[model samples]
Target: MAQECRIPHTVLCPARTPTCQTSPYLEAIRRQLAVRTRRLNDTGALTPGPPTASGQSDDPDTHDGPARPVVQLLLCRYLAEHAVEHLRCVAQTRHRHRCPHPIRALTGPAGTWRLLPTGPRRGQLALPDVLMAIYDLGHLPYRGQLRWRAQRCPQHDAAPGAADLALAEWQPFDPLLHAAHIRTRLPHPEARRPGSR
Candidate 1:
């Protein structure tokens, strides 16, 4: 039997009733992008999650996917996202119930993740500078009132100066977004504090 999934702040919100609030296609896209771009080895193999047609090794432990520091950072970010996204947001238990906002933090450390202005204007401070500034480290990606998106996700479609590549073409590369994660993890002064307590 399928177990029931509980979501927080959404108990009052109906499930499977249909709403722009949730779109399966968007979720699918998000997940697909996450898989193709977020999960991979430095050599660009499908090691973090499963093997692709590319002949990379199938792996469940993300940490073992990459050896380079940058690769390690990228893998950690993806692993954290996978962990948070799968959490039970609908649980009634105070300790267990949580939204997805801290996810941003988990995506990377502080400042590593930022909000860009969005509106009809060329450039305006339409959005707040810092969001969900709270939450403990590793407990990042707390669901906020808003969601983060790129020009498109999967970079193959949305990132600038990036080309859209098919799964076959992507057989050996991860997302540039993962680069941001890598850059953030460096011991540089620029590294943002991990977005958690």
Candidate 2:
């Protein structure tokens, strides 16, 4: 009779710990950690790459090219946290000042997003939740075309003059920016300084 190879169950075996043995929740957590690690390893992953010699530009206005996957993810996450009311026209006027126009308006009793029409477009275009999911609007059809129009005010969208627009800038997304809103209760009143009030 062959000798029985007895091993303590408490000891974790290298081969025994296969991914298949892990719980679905643990597996999901592992996958998320792996993704985060990969992103961290990639330098400047959240930001767009430098303009390439092959005509690839970082300026969204000039370059119709697809945005990087990381950038798209960051943008989607940021936009999700910050409402449309916070967004402003990125376009610059002839005088070199930022355009003083809201990108889109929350109109009506329901407060739906209505695109400020470019011209005699009488009907208000309501932005569907499905449409908001799109990161790069350039790929979509006419609806996407209309969506992109919101990036600028009606004046700039209708007549984009020859102006050296600013290059699109990207910064690392900070979840803590909206920490107070996510919390269950407001910060204790005692936390505030006496003179600040």
Candidate 3:
């Protein structure tokens, strides 16, 4: 529909509009599709109220977009916690459970990163901050399932498949989440499921 409508980023999407595919805009539809597809196991969310052990609610039923404001509040809290968890892990110098959401690579390490069609380095600098807004404002409910852990760094290849093997047994930073790294090979949500492939 994006192509038909003269919008960029639609040639690869191939979905028609006015059919209620899932999002009001291209971005949200894409975001929601990604999170739900990768989460191998989901614990869902809890009802929110005051604060809990993490000092936040576990609610997932609210959001501000297609979902109501309450829904956004619940999802935003969870996503914020996820961002905090990521920051802490990276700071401690521990390799995280490779997220396997099959995303476009954000960067290798920033300054030396390459540019791609999706856009420039929007992730490294303000990903965490932007994530907060994505949930709170975008009302994005696809947080836990968006993994992009399939690492392509040539540095890791010296081990020759060792990194992939290690990830299989390594303890998950957040066992509650089925985190997987994004890679080129993973199944894309927009692709039509094969009759047998």
lDDT of each: 0.28, 0.36, 0.25
Superposed on all Cα atoms, model 1 deviates from the true structure by an RMSD in Å of 22.1
Query: What are the per-residue Cα lDDT tens digits for candidate 2 across 1-30?
Result: 999965343232222344346656655655
Candidate 1 lDDT, 35-125, residue by residue in tens:
5553332223422334568755443312321222221121122212332223222212223432223223344343232211111223433
- Candidate 3, poorest ten consecutive residues by summed lDDT: 110-119
Q: By descending lDDT, how would the candidates be arranged?
A: 2, 1, 3
For model 2, where is the 10-residue window of minimal lDDT?
109-118
Model 1: weakest 10-residue lDDT segment is: 164-173
Q: Which candidate number would show the highest TM-score if scored against the true structure?
A: 2
Report the C-alpha displacement of residue 35, candidate 3, in angstroms: 28
Model 3: per-residue lDDT, tens digit, 1-197? 35555544552233333343434576576666556533421212211134468864343322211111111222121222232112111111124554332221233211111111111132333222111112221221233122222222333322334334223112222212312311111112222122212
| Runs with alpha carbons beyond 4 Å of true place in candidate 1 | 1-40, 43-57, 61-82, 90-197
Backbone-clash count (model 3): 20
Task: List the candidate 3 regions with Cα displacement exceeding 4 Å.
Answer: 1-49, 52-163, 166-197
